[model samples]
Target: MPQANIDPAIKSVHVFSTGAGEQHKEHRYGSPLPRLLWALTSQSWIKIPVNAFVIEHRDGLVLFDTGLDPAIKSDPNYINSAIGRFLLRRIFRLHIGPDERLHKKLEAMGFAAADIRKAVISHLHFDHVGGIADIPQADLLVSKDEWAQLSAPHPEREWILREHIEIPGAKWRPVEFAPTDDPLFAPFGGSYDVMGDASMILLPTPGHTPGSMSMLVRTGDTPPLLLVGDLTYQADLLMKDQVPGTGDAKLLRSSFAKVRTLKKQFPDLVILASHDPETADILAASHSSRP
Candidate 1:
């Protein structure tokens, strides 16, 4: 029962939360933004939480985004947080070095490194890919556009690709989500049945990072859960109609529109935040099952 996302046989299933953690560093770097941003987001100041959601499917495991890795796991600098003089380097995640890991948790649930079918990265960012090594056998499923945007000769953020994007081992499967299911996009879009009735629908909710994507999880006749990656850092922000840390103004607005629509369609659906402690609590309580 714990191994499947749904009733297993009822509809093929597999989705994992991997683990949960927190981040308290948004105020220092957030204040410089235009007043309009603060006015729109109502978050001119405050440290925020960074969370990671890992999903498992019948054929593979889809990681919504990678959170802090081993580097930050044992870093003394990150252990202690102060109000002033916050260290950015201490906050930024690094490529997982060794030892500190999430594999043990997965193994405890009877899963092996090779058990992961695919690690779908919502976008190319360190926090989301920190646990890449945890699923060595799985191919890296990422959006070609996202990769292109990050790996472009002149990328917007250099740190996004630095080693994490171009890693050793594992197969990299780049996919393009389609608006109408072209050969390239159909396989990547709509609701994807993992193992059971549980599905991860890749909604093209760009704007957060050009190629940013969000997922919809349906299970147990329960309220659907939408994993909106990085679109908004805080769940309350979405619930309160605020803005996120970073996103193309227009694109963010478009995605925000989707957010409102989804909320209306599935009022009971849990709209999760990747970097919100409250969301992590919800995930731990609601989605604690290994499957």
Candidate 2:
């Protein structure tokens, strides 16, 4: 079969690894017994990359997620509360360095932190929003439901830390999805067109967190990409309707079904997850395949 040409207007798409870390398999899969057993007997850890996607849109530079902050590993006060710190260690293992900071990573990719005009936040998880402070000038967009969590007392309990998100001088914009006439996005019920050109469309996927979202990127020369943030540890799992250990399983299933429908509609659609190990290689292939 002949290959399809992608949008020439999209200069390039780049993926950066903010850091590399590992989490218990049980924490990634489901159920409490396995996690307890692993805590007691096993030492298996699944390596995953904390990733952020950068798109070279014609209008400006846009980021899918901000990735992680190196401070989490370097600073003792990163988590703030002692209890939070204790829980964090029990759940995962992080291996990050000073050079892995968002700004530095962007610099390594030939982009400046100031070049990011818009940032689509998948959710308020500390790992995803860790670099928001690095780009205070960028318009940070988050779903209204996700932003609402910040107003509740101690959102950090749910991993949505206000201390990092509510930082001074940050441009936070909470957006609501509107009905879309486009059938391609009909499964999502509504969509938010980030660039108003169908180049990047934001669809609410929820499940992992109340306002979790996935980004649909369409370029003339490349297959559409659905950047799902922590929706599932892997894209294959999502296709099989395997819900992760964290998050609302029912909601995850509902979101998973919607994503499956999207795949049915656009078979070549690439679903990119935040923690997926293949994101870097897949993104590189996408770029290489571009016209």
Going through the candidates in the order shown, the clash numbers are 18, 7
- Local error of candidate 1 at residue 63 (angstroms): 3.2
Model 2: ten consecutive residues of lowest lDDT? 1-10
lDDT of each: 0.56, 0.85
TM-score of 1: 0.69
Per-residue accuracy of model 1 over 1-291 as CA lDDT, tens digit each:
212344432222233343444332342223356633443444223344555555555445555664556655465443233421133333332334444455754565565655666666777765677677667777776666677776576442333634555667757777765454423124334433333343555666676677777777765544567787777776666665566445565777667676676666556667786666567566655554422
Structural similarity to truth (TM-score) of each candidate: 0.69, 0.93
Error of 1 at 137 (Å): 1.7
lDDT of 2 by residue, 83-133 (tens): 788777777788888878889999988999999999999999998998998
Residue pairs whose backbone atoms clash in candidate 2:
5-221, 6-220, 6-221, 6-222, 7-219, 7-220, 7-221
User: Cα-based RMSD of the predictions, in order?
Assistant: 7.2, 2.7
